[model samples]
Target: MQLVRWGILSTAKIGTQKVIPAMQQSDLCEVLAIASRNQATADEAATKLGVPRAYGSYEALLADPDIDAVYNPLPNHLHVPWSIRALDAGKHVLCEKPIGLSAAEGEKLLATASRHPELKVMEAFMYRHHPQWQAAKRLVEDEEIGALRAIQVAFSYYNVDPKNVRNVAEIGGGGLMDIGCYCISLARFLFDTEPKKVCGLVENDPNFGTDRLASAILDFGTGQASFVCSTQMVPYQRVNVFGTEGRIEIEIPFNAPPDLPCRIWHEKEGATNEVVLDVCDQYTVQCDLFSSAILNDTPVPTPLSDAVANMRVIEAIRASASSGKWV
Candidate 1:
């Protein structure tokens, strides 16, 4: 496959710590450009990541004729616009999760991307690519857990820093947007179907004016998924799935940092079967998949079409919590 030259749209912490490193490590991709709202930061990142080009503005990177793909690690508010910009510039995009404020926003972005047949836009949910998750999916399909019927996923971390962007609603800060999204996204992937309805409860922080903790129940066609997430709690992440005859549990960080290792348990013939997977870099897998989609024109794993479904569930959760009634 021909190398896809990648341009990162920001010097965000995730970009510096996960994505840039993964792209550099991927043989199918190259870190061709780095851009930031700040010129000095862009230059610094380009030098640090060994990217060949640096730009002070997002548009400058988009205008680069050589850039085949773009990574939009910009803040949540800019996700849709920047992704649209990249698509219009004829570049495939791998955008960070919560790519829109609502499902409608994601739909609009998808529409914009659809106009560019030569381009593809995908949400960056790197955990889905981890070997641990792959094993979990195989176990589910193998009926190690019998016919899957229910699931529970949780991801929370205490970000007590008052100045952190997650505590601010204006910048898309909240439990539902920050960590809860993992639960929602995972539910869709685990169930392999969109939730028909959702019920939720939210507890907002008095100091931050954002929902610091939230929980939701997703009603799939044949099963149910319960999700709990927070940004003002002790760090925790795990997933459990139950079926008619048995169950499976993946005990580890299920999202956020990629390449997390997890253990699975299966109940068969009145006995418990368990296995642990080796830790793998989920970010590298994510980059690998994105590059494959670009080079081979294969369908994106988590396309904007499906990502919008997760956003809709989140919107429903927010509505249910705010209205004190099912949405």
Candidate 2:
């Protein structure tokens, strides 16, 4: 099997602590190098993650002729710029979620990708690769829940660190960009289409100047999806899909633990059935799928256009919040 040689663009915690390790376990991925602004930091991360090479500058990593792809886990503001650079350097790109600071920025990356027909570009929404989500989608499509009518999601965590990237405002730090994007993506994913309209309510933290709490209702015509996400609330995450005759509840939807069996409850006609999935690391699944696409000349699981669409929803929700009207 030919493994894709991957170079990580940063030592971001999500990559070093979760994604890189998971990719290391993949048969289709080889984490060849890691890069950082500082040589020492890059070296430390490369050694810690067992990557073979370390580069002080992102440009150096991008210039590596052996690298087939780049995993960009940079901050929200840098996602597009670096991903575009990777594409220009002749490498496929798997960028972190909330693809860019706004829909316009995501479109820029999409445009750059279009100019490079040979390269694959994808926004990493790792949760979608989890089997639990796949099962949930199957159940919805199979109508085990009888025509899907609604989806309610609640994802939150208490965080107030002023210096944290998620708390900063200028560089696209906020609950919506950081976590709420997942909620919007979920609605589009389950519905298999874009929302007709959306209304949102946001509460910004005075100190951080970033939204600490947000709730939105996405009108999907056939059904509706509502979600509330917070950065200053109890740590919890869940999703419930309701239909005319039944419903499905995902027990740990977003952060599905790799070590524990995941479960989804299906209730119909007052009878509940539990569907349990074997332990699996979603990141590993995500890595292999992206790698396979690169090796096989196949489409990525999620396209650059989808990333732009998700960003448009996010922008609309913010617009709705400000204008006090559906958008």
Candidate 3:
């Protein structure tokens, strides 16, 4: 494939404002078409985003032979279903995070992706592709943080729109499902292991019937990862990896800025060091990596199986919260 022709499944804000523009910046791919529930809406997005084609329905976009791949930014509940539909249509997929509402649902989607081995399916965890994260991983693996002991991550933002899809529980709305997944994913990435046990605490929004504030502790045998995520708290994001000999702190860990340098602070034995990374767009890196993988028959950065593993940990956390005990 000289260049992958891409189609977007929804006119989601994240697509219009972030990923699409980032993908457009990648030389390996071109976003040719976009779809929305309404024709006018799709057309508006196409014109605004400079896409060449617009379809009123997702199925129409999937049917277009010109589209070789799809970016599924549909709501959480629609992720697996729409991704499966695109896969059946012979289009590779890059679905947004938390690919399913639960582990069982994620498993079914994973099985579907498995059957279509010719196509690539990846979860859109844009952060993992950023240089800052890559540097952090190298430092940890190099023992710059000494022997990793624990990890701390937090991602939160205040969203009070009751009518927004994120505030509706019936559609898989919650902090844990929304931003909390970042904490869980990063923990697993840095530790390079899965948790043996977990515990959690969550406070729900009675009116919305969704978790507003949540926290979890994942015991990874060799280390422990703890995080707090909230949709009703002050906006903040940070990650810290603690080791027996030192620690590394990431200021712009998750939602890194594309226009400014990102840095990691390391402290050890009464000394400190800072690693500076150039201004970079993680979404662009993510799209380019996936496109290159597809073109060269290499491996994607974040595969569907990895999403299933993260979902399993997420399910365990929810279970622990419900039972008020370790799970």
Candidate 4:
């Protein structure tokens, strides 16, 4: 089996502490190098993670001829620009989501991607690759939950450090962009369509100028999805899917632990059935799938258009919050 050589763009916690380790475990992925703005930082990360090479700059990593793909876990503002650079350098890109700061920015990346038909690009929404989600999708399709009617998601964590990237408003740090995007993405994923309209309520932090609490209702024509996300609450995450006859509840939806079994509950006729999925790293599954697509010249599981669509919903929700009307 040919492994796709991967270069990481940053030592961001998600990459170094989570994604990089999982990618290292994948049969189809090779963590060839990692880059940071500072050579010493890059070198330290490389030494710690067992990556083969360390580059002082992202450009140097992208310029490597042996690197077949790039995993971009840069800040929200840098996602599009760096991914475009990687594409221009003839490397496939797997960028972390919300793909860009806005829908227009995402569209710009889409145009860049269109110009490179030979290369593949994908937004890293790893939760979608998990078997537990796949099982939930199948149950909904199989009518085990009757007719899908609504989805309610509550994702929150407590973090108020002013220096934390998530608290900075200038570079796309907010509850919505950070964790709420998952709610929007999963709703669209399960509904298998974009929302017709959306209404939102956001509460921004006075000091940080970023949203600390947000709630929204997405009208998906056939059904509705509602979600609330927070940056200053007890750390909790869950997703519930409701139907005419029954409901399905996902436990620990977004941050499923790789070492523990994941479970979802199906309720019908006053009885609940618990379904548990075997342990697996979603990050490994996601990276391997993208690498396989590149090696086999196949379409990515989630397209760039999906990222743009999800961004539009996010923008619309913000607009609705400001205008006090559904958008």
Predicted structure with the largest lDDT when compared to the true one: 4
- TM-score: model 2 vs. ground truth: 0.99
State the lDDT of candidate 1 residue by residue for 1-327, as single tens digits: 589899999999989887888778888989899998879999998888788999999899999999999999877888998899899898999999888888888998999987987787899988888877787788778887788899988788888677877887888888898778888887788788888888999999999888988998889878999988888888888888888888777777454344445567767668887777776677888998889987888888777888898888889999999898877
TM-score of 4: 0.99
lDDT of each: 0.85, 0.95, 0.93, 0.96
Better of 3 and 4 by lDDT: 4
Candidate 2 lDDT at 308 equals 94
Model 1 clashing residue pairs (backbone): 259-282
Q: Which parts of model 2 have CA positions greater than 4 angstroms off? A: none
What's the distance in Å from true for residue 72, model 1? 0.6
Model 4 misplaced regions, further than 4 Å: none
lDDT of 4: 0.96
**RMSD each, Å:** 1.7, 0.7, 0.9, 0.7
Model 4: how far is 5 from its true place, Å?
0.2
Better of 2 and 3 by lDDT: 2
- Candidate 1 residues lying further than 4 Å off, grouped into runs, are 253-261
What's model 4's lDDT at 223?
Answer: 98
What lDDT tens digits, residue by residue, belong to model 3 across residues 1-327?
A: 389999999999999999999998889999999999999999999999899999999989999999999999999999999999999999999999888888899888889988999999999999999999998899899998789999998889999899888899988899999998999999999989889999999999988988999999999999999999999999999998999999999998988998899999999897989989999899999999999988988889877888999999988989999999999
